[model samples]
Target chain A: MRATYMFGAGDVRVIDVPDPVIERPTDAIVRIVRACVCGSDLHPYHGLPATAEGIPMGHEFVGVVEETGRDVATLKKGDLVIAPFAWSDGTCDFCREGLHTSCRHGGFWGRNGIGGGQAEAVRVPLADGTLVKVPVGEDSALLASLLTLSDVYGTGYHAAVKAGVNERTTVTVIGDGAVGLMAVLSAKQLGAERIILMGRHQARTDLGREFGATDVVAERGEAGIAAVRELTGGDGTHTVLEAVGHMPAYRQAIGVVRPGGVISRVGVPQYEEAPIGFGSLFGPNVTLTGGPAPVRAYIEPLLPRVLDGSVNPGRVFDREVGLEQTPEAYKAMDAREALKVLVRP
Target chain B: MRATYMFGAGDVRVIDVPDPVIERPTDAIVRIVRACVCGSDLHPYHGLPATAEGIPMGHEFVGVVEETGRDVATLKKGDLVIAPFAWSDGTCDFCREGLHTSCRHGGFWGRNGIGGGQAEAVRVPLADGTLVKVPVGEDSALLASLLTLSDVYGTGYHAAVKAGVNERTTVTVIGDGAVGLMAVLSAKQLGAERIILMGRHQARTDLGREFGATDVVAERGEAGIAAVRELTGGDGTHTVLEAVGHMPAYRQAIGVVRPGGVISRVGVPQYEEAPIGFGSLFGPNVTLTGGPAPVRAYIEPLLPRVLDGSVNPGRVFDREVGLEQTPEAYKAMDAREALKVLVRP
Candidate 1:
């Protein structure tokens, strides 16, 4: 089978690899239908400590169950499904508390030892808990939505919810990536009265506006915060969704949120130590929440909305290609030429 | 009137000063009954930025209203009361959101233009919103509780509540100061099943145990995190209250909390920047909430408990002195000679 492997930073390639068979009683094998380049994947591409040689690439995917282990339940061969980036045992205390991303036995799909989704076929362990089955015969356009539910959509929704987005909230979404766009959608769905998307790209900014972004700020750094404050009647937004995981972006998100408001960050921190202003956090009474997304917990609540066409997150997939072209797709994504590039096996 | 002032780091003196009079329509003058040294007060004592002035000292005090301005309606002359550290209008959006500590027009006492409580008489602005009236003719012993209600007790309660303490929660409280000790009591009152007080003094630890602390860990750093984990069946506590405002204490609190659990920080951050691991924060799905002690909001709910004998946090006060000894009290608190020192003016 052909799979994507990273030899070094910016060295992702599609290569022939041995097929995966059930290595654990809970493992299941799936033939991927659609997958995409994720914002988190860019971290390793840009050279973080988590990136390594011979590492499998990609964590978001929608696929069909090709085989299942004897112990797996609630899923069968040929079921169309979406799997979250992190695989959990489903019974750990954190998982039981609906925080699967922090499950005691959970692990990321691509970073450490697991094979990822930017490939033709992949082995998924703990399939019954990690994969959500989509209703059969859904349109292919739903593939984009399913792919998003795997990570970006669930993550963006988690960010919005953590930021306490409600009918009275005025939100500032600090990114133009797929997750940020989806956060704008999530904010709108969560009944935020207004959403300001801070981004610099025309294409992604337009996508953000279409996804319920009521305002846009193309500036960065202090200027970005100034723009948000200017739009929020000079009090700052009531909620800020931080989707870019970097020091500057984090600072911007924290800066533009109103006193007693929140900064919900879904950005995968690219560095081990992100500098935070404790005085600002405590003095302003800000609430900070985010971590690996509890995607498993959000899928059930979000599936009906996605299936019923209440959200059109598929618009984020500006480009689509076959699995064989994933290397070029990675390049395009790295260059910021594509909002999100979908690949089908 | 005489008030305690800081001339420099470690330099405090009881000096004769002009008596305060009503300066605003919402102001009220109070004859301070009891004032106590706070951990935050030591921040300026240890010489941080803005620490080089003859600033009046003290914010936590229980007092009798000596006079009221024309617009002061909720409080009256001769009424006993506990004033929140932060003054708010009580009608702003932040106050209505139960975040009076972060009210738009909020101002702190005992810093800059605000007068301190360690004096014969002090002026309180936003008197109607910031001062909670205690029952008239309350005994002097109630002064201990009333004094605590002004800051430490309320701050501890704020930390516990923000940490989401409840019957099912296993709480770990960092710091053994008056606020941390009160947090042990607060967690117990909130029905926490297991309470661990991290402290070094056997006397204070005994008091904490009496206040419902099921365990005590004198060790700091990794050892402390290990002790908490061992107590929680290797899962760590569900709620952690951080009362010590320092880098090590903050890190320790974060290290010991369980995934999906809450860390409520009442420790005022003295540093402009705090180092946090964003990867670990988001990956573990932890929730952080904190800020200044919202004493005004909690006074109503907790006062009844204090008055009815359902809760008594006054046991934390280990020493009492006349206002003339305010300088010695600060020195004793600085040297950890007293768990908490209550001053009678």
Candidate 2:
């Protein structure tokens, strides 16, 4: 089986690897139907050092179950399904609390000897808890949108939900990436009155507008904060959905969040320390929230919207590639030529 | 008139000061009937450098409206009122949103030439907004609890409310100070099923238990975290109400919070930076929130409970001192000899 691996910074390749097989009674073998490059994957693509064995990649995927262990109860071979970024045992306390990302028995894909999703086939642990069955057929056009439920869309939804966005809220999203656009869509779906998208790219911001951003700010840093505040009547937005996890983005979140509002960061943070004392979050009563999205908990509610054509999150996939072209998929996304690159294995 | 002043670290004195007069149409002069030493007051007492012009002390007070400016509508002369620590004009976006602490026309009690609550009379700006009318008389037995509604009780309740405490939540309060005891009482009032009070003082913890702490963890650092984990089946509590502003209390909040839980810090943070990256909050989905309590917003709802005898937040005050003995009041609280000091002018 061919799988994606990063040989070093800016180096990605599809190489032959041993096929995955169900190794535990709770595991299942999934033949990947679709997968994609993520913005988070760029973190390693930019700084990961070369290794002898290389590192497996990809954490989001939709697949058809090829084989299942005897203990798997709710799923069977040939079921079309989506896998959240992390696998969890549904019965764990954290999982029961709808925080599957922190499940005690769960671990992220592509770690701890697990096969990456950007492969022809992968072993999924805790299959019953990790995979949400999709009623659509493998050939359904809704597959692309349904695939987003596994991570991006659900992540954006989580940011909005955690931030308490509602019809009375004015939101500012500080990224033009697929996740940020999904956040705009989610805020709109949740009934946010206004959304401001801060991005330099015209094409992406245009898509953001289509997704319900009522305003756009092309500036960065202090000027960007001024623009957002101006758009929000000098008070900034009620919620700042921060989908860019860099220090500057975090600073802008602090700058443009209204007093008593929330800053929800969906992007994987690139830095650790940030100001949260009286000078920032504490003085204004700003809430700092957001984390690895527990997409497993969100899939059930968001799936119906995708199936009903009320939302079109698949528009984020501006490019697609075949299994052998996975390397180009990474390059295209890294070069900003593609918002998100879909992969067919 | 006499007012409390902090001339330097470890120094508090009552000194003659000019009587306050209304400087704005919205202002009213409050004759101090009751004032108290706060944990936060100790911050300046412990570290404030010596100065020619000493900082005025105290922010919590229940008083009589001695005089009101022509524009003061809701309050009149001789009315009994509880003033929140901060003053604000009631008609601002932040105030309208129930975030009076962030009111556009608001300021703290002791700053900007305003008289502190410990003075013989305080000229309260935005009288209609900052003071809540208390139905009880100055001689009522509930005066102590009503005084708490000005700061301590309201601040603790803010922590619980911001953390979203409810019947299903297990709460851990990280302080035994007056505010911490108030937090235990607030959590119980909010219906938290399990309340863990983390403090070492026997008398304080005993009062905390009476206030509804189901368990007491007297250990600090790792031992404290372990004790809390053991109490919650190794998952920690669903909500951590942090009433201590120091870094250690913040660290303990991180150590014992369950995944996807909330940390509500009501205490004024003494530090500016803390970890919030993958190694801490982000990975576990912990939401960091809470700030200075908008006591003005909380006073109305909590007043009924205080009046009805269902809650006794006033029990936190263990000692009393006259205005002339304000120096000793600070000493007793600083030495932990008194849970909180009630001041009579």
RMSD of each: 1.9, 1.4
Model 1 per-residue lDDT tens digits across residues B1-345: 889988888888899888898898999999998888887888888884445458888888888998999999888888998888778889888788888887777788876477898888899988988888888464655778777888999899999988789999899999899889989999998999799999988898999999999999999999988988888888778888998878888788788888878888898865655555554466677777788877778888888878877777888888988999988888888889988898888
For model 1, the superposed segments whose C-alpha errors exceed 4 Å read: A48-53, A111-113, B48-53
TM-score of each candidate?
0.96, 0.98
lDDT of 2 at A61: 95
DockQ of candidate 2 against the true complex: 0.85
- Candidate lDDT scores, in order, read 0.85, 0.92
Worst lDDT window (10 residues) for model 1 chain A? A271-280
Per-residue lDDT tens digits of candidate 2, residues B127-168? 998899988788989989899998999999999999999999
Worst lDDT run of 10 residues, candidate 1 chain B, spans: B271-280
Could you give candidate 1's per-residue lDDT for residues A1-345 as a string of tens digits?
998887777888898888978888798899888889998888778784544457888889888888999999988998999989888888877788898987778788765557989988889988888888989543466788878988999899999988789999999999999999999999999998799999999899998988899899999999988988888888898888989988888889777989878888898766666544455677777888887788988889999988888887888999988888888888899999888999887
lDDT per residue for candidate 2 within A1-345, as digits (tens), equals 999988889888899899898799999999999999899999999999987788888899999999999899999989999999889999988899899999989999888989888889899999999999988889999988988887899999999999999999999999999999999999999999799999998999999999999999999999999998888778898899999889999999999999999999999999887899999999999999999999999999999989999899999999999988988998898889999999999
TM-score of candidate 2 restricted to chain B? 0.99
